[model samples]
Target chain A: MKDPMIDIRNLSVTFNRGRKPVKAVNGVSLSVNSGEVVALLGESGSGKSVTMRSLLRLHPKGTSIEGSMRVAGNDVTELSARELADYRGATVSMVFQEPRLALDPVYTLGQQIEEAIMRHENVSRREAALRALGLFEKVRIPSPERRLMNYPHEMSGGMLQRSMIAMAIACNPKVLLADEPTTALDATVQIQILLLIRELQKEYGLSVIFVTHDIGVAAEVADRIAVMYAGRIVEEGKVADVIQNPKHPYTRGLLGARVELAHGRDRLITIPGAPPDLAALPPGCAFAPRCAEAAAQCITDVPRLTAIDDTASVACVRYA
Target chain B: MINLVGEPSPILPVGERGGPAQPLISVRGLLKHFPVKGSGFLKPKKVVHAVDGVDFDILKGETLGVVGESGCGKSTTARLLMQLITPDRGEILFDGESAGETLPLSEYRRQVQMVFQDSYASLNPRLTIEESIAFAPRVHGVPAAKAIARAHDLLHRVGLEPVRFAGRYPHELSGGQRQRVNIARALALEPRLVILDEAVSALDKSVEAQVLNLLLDLKRDFGLTYLFISHDLNVVRFMCERVMVMYLGKVAEIGERDAIFEKTRHPYSSALLASMPKMNPGERTLEPPLSGDPPNPIDPPAGCRFHTRCSFAEDVCRQTLPPLSRISGAQSAACLMAMTNSGHSRAPVQMEA
Candidate 1:
């Protein structure tokens, strides 16, 4: 394959809190080909969101990142503060979980998108506004001309989200990192947003790293799926392969736990146990405590990602 | 002008013989519209149709699931049933009797209780689980010792370790454990009907299952009736014997769990079912989502409120409001097409194909 659009190798993120340190992302390596959508799938506190956020260096000031993290062929760790500023919203853009909060409350939707374009691209205010309007139309925000004048609160949640997407794509970035962009949206609106994202990804040849806790969403949109658990990716494969024939116990549990509306009247299955505290992670595999198939070795040595098949990798002793 | 009521009355009906077979709560045409006044001095008044024209019956010892998106008025309906808000129109009957007026609802209050969505802030941080659970009973004049004993029994019923959790404050418990305490507290008054408003929505998947299972078990053991309101379709399908789909503050569809899931007649209901994210990648076909949010509730569409988003809408759909009509033996929907299909052939065949 032509050099992957984004490559992350052995990426680790640690947050220091007084004497205690939280390893939020542990040795995660991911790659996304041009125009492909990769999903970071896991439940809350599973470190999926943190792993993707670390790609942008969006974590708090206390965070310390290690390993080779490159996006669009640029070494992210080597970028100076000034370069990092230009990199964000220019080379790689993000769509946050809550669009209402992500947007400036005082500014109109059009103004925000225009601001994003002008900040990254040296353009006149008129040109930026025109570009913002064009982006809004591309994202299917109806009556883009009128909506441009509406404040974040004036527009509905779905419209605001589309506006956010419009801003993200205004720079024509190579990589789009969406962190649970549709989590706060209703189901019907979520469908529209996902479709829009997929369309934009193909149209712009953009590599998308979509993060979400909902496995169903990942199944729908992801070309490749990475199942994270307790700061590490336990399984990675094509969405079809990983969802249908998942190798890791955590992935299986997650799939089984979803209540398929199509499964009319079947008893719902669910996993047991809350996620482990990041500050006090277990010594062995992070999911070992919750894994139904965990063996003696699982509680001692942490499992590394091993090839389960040509298309899949599983970090589990059973698969190994 | 509306009459200022003495107090908000419980929706539970009165005078019906308490029995295992009779439904615990029945609501009809429940409406609660808040007047929206503009910020300016000369602002015109508008009504926010928060909960408009809702009706459902919760059977004794059965869970009735209410599913809808945000702003669909599911929570508002729950609050109305609990008599936390006075309805602008309609009647609520508990058991066999109308819970007459606001003041008279005091007698009906003990029979109904509610569990809110946020378990974190629902319980008093300063009060221990024992005290939280005992608050209701003690206020109703139950002896202190008796209420404490009852609270302990309720704690055990909700699967909480009485000794460990009894004296612990709300902040001391985990999310799941704290929710269990909330459930125990709601049951402290020995209510026959419990309204759970998004009770498990905020919980993680695993913890949600534990609480849901606990709810099912409690329903069986205590012979309780539940009006379970939630936005998660998965949770609703699992917990409810019958499901009610709401849209724009109206009942879109209602039927047995299997019936609604298998044969949803309403366009809005079908869109909602289609919009849900599927775990099976093979099932991820390009189904279109509903185009936009429901028309502003303040000025809902004239005919079918859903006509604005309905892909198969007809001319009549925009001009004439469809009434709740029978779709099949057990299913009911407010759709003109379903009602026009009087012949069995049209109804069944159209649904199948």
Candidate 2:
């Protein structure tokens, strides 16, 4: 196979390394080819968002990152300060969960998109504005011309999200990183945003990494899913296989715990205990304490992610 | 038509619990209109009809799910039921007694408690887990020692050990743990009805499952009723025996869980169900089930609040307010299309330009 559009190997990110370090992402390796969509699926503090944000090196100054990240064959972590600026939107762009926070409140939607375009390419203000308008239309925003003048607060949550998506793709980045883009929108609007992302990805042949805590949303959009727990990828495989026949205990627990899957059951089968704290995770497997199938080995040995078949891999004592 | 004024005879016979067939909580013509800003001088005052004419009944020991998008007044309805805010024009009957009239406000409040979405915000930061849970019971005249003991037991029931967690402040606990403590506090007063306003929405999926199960178990043990309000259709379906679908502060549909999910009668409810992201990849919806956000509630569409977005909306739907008509046993919908059985006859309205 050709080189993946976005590639990361042995990626690890730690915040506030001196006093009390938080290991946000640990030894996560993933790749997405052109036009492919890989969903980083996990609950809060599971490192899905952290790992995706690493592609653009968006962490604070004191944070330490140890990883090899490549997007469109450009080394991400190795990029110089000057090169990093260009690398951010030209090679990859991100859509944040809260558009209100991500967007500049004072700036109109058109201004933000135009600024994003102008930053990447040598273009006149007029040209950038035209590109921004085109992007608005492409993302299916109603009355693109009128919407461009509306400030971020003027637009609804769904509209702001679409504007965010429109900005992310303004430069036509090789890879799109959507970090729970639809989480803040309503259910009906969430579906619209999800379908819009999928449609835009296919239309532009863009490789996308969509991060979400929702299994249903992941199932709907992702071609492959990488399930994160604590700070590691516990399970990774095709959406259908991983969801239908999960190998990892955590993945199985997530599926079993889904309220949608609990339609006929009297009681939902829940994974006992809470997620391990990222600041001070437990020894051995992070999920062992909550796993019903945990054995003695799971408590003592940190299992490595091993391929169970051609399409799937699981990090568990059972698979290891 | 059901009388909106002084209590009429019970709609159904006394239920199995030997109570008058009257529901534990019956809401009628509930309306809350908040005056909008910038309406004093040149412009006529406009009122945001936050909870416009919403009516429903919560039978004893039953979970009545309220599902709608943000601004659809699900939270307002919960707030109204909790008496956090009084309705402008409507009546809430608790156990066949008018909430604030026949039933004293304090008495009604004692029997009804609310759990909000943000657990941390709802909890008092100054109080420990035990103190937070015990405070309510103490206010209700329970002895301090007994309330403390009850708090401990309640904490344990919610899967939080009192020995380790009782002394911890709200800030020290995890999101899920704080939520459990919130639930424990809600139950501390021994309330018969608990209104969970997006209670489990802020937790992780796994944690949400645990809390949901705990809620169900508590319901069975305490014979409690729940008004579960959430935007998550799946969680609502799982938790609620009867579901109410709201749109623009109005009841679009209300029915048994199966009727609402399997044999939906309202266009809005069907759209809501269809909008749920398919769990199966093969069955992924090609197009968005519905387009656009709900229209502003300040000046909702002339007749049916949902007519602007309803695919089957007609000229009549725009001018005539459709009453909630019985679709089947214990299932009803407020839609002209449903009443006329012409849901599939007309093509869906074209997407707004």
Per-model chain B TM-scores are 0.89, 0.90
User: What does DockQ give for each predicted structure?
Assistant: 0.48, 0.82
In the range B1-353, model 1's lDDT, one tens digit per residue, is 77778678544433336565766777899999888667336776678788888877777767889987888888888888878888999988887677756427777888889999889889888898899999999999999999999999999888887888899998877888889999998988777888899898877776776687788778877777898888788778878888999888888888888888788888788888888887777777475668876567777778888888887787778887777776776788987768764332223334545
lDDT tens string, model 2, A116-176?
Answer: 8888899999999999989888988889999999999888999999999899888978899
Q: TM-scores across all candidates?
A: 0.92, 0.94
Q: Candidate 2, which CAPRI tier?
A: high
How far off is each candidate at the interface, as Cα RMSD in Å?
A: 2.6, 0.9
Candidate 2 clash pair list: B13-B21, B14-B21
Residues B1-353, model 2: lDDT tens digits: 86679777455322233384669998999999899989957888898989988788998879999999999999999898999987898899888888888779887888899999999999999999999999988988999999999999999998888999999999999998999999999888778899999999988998888889989999998878899998998898888999999988889999999999999988899999999988889999898878998788888899888878877777877788888888789799988777654333442343456
Q: Name the runs in model 2 displaced over 4 angstroms.
A: B1-20, B340-353
**For every candidate, what share of the true interface contacts is present?**
0.58, 0.87
Report the lDDT tens digits of candidate 1 across residue range A1-320. 58888889999899887788988888998888888999998877778888888778888897899999878888999999999999998999999999988999998888888888888889999999899888888988778899999999888888888888888989989999999999888888898889889888888988899998777789888999999988899999999998888888888877766655325533456676778888888888888888777788988998999987777899988878
Q: What lDDT does candidate 1 reach at residue B126?
A: 88
Q: Relative to the true structure, how large is the alpha-carbon lDDT of every model?
A: 0.83, 0.89
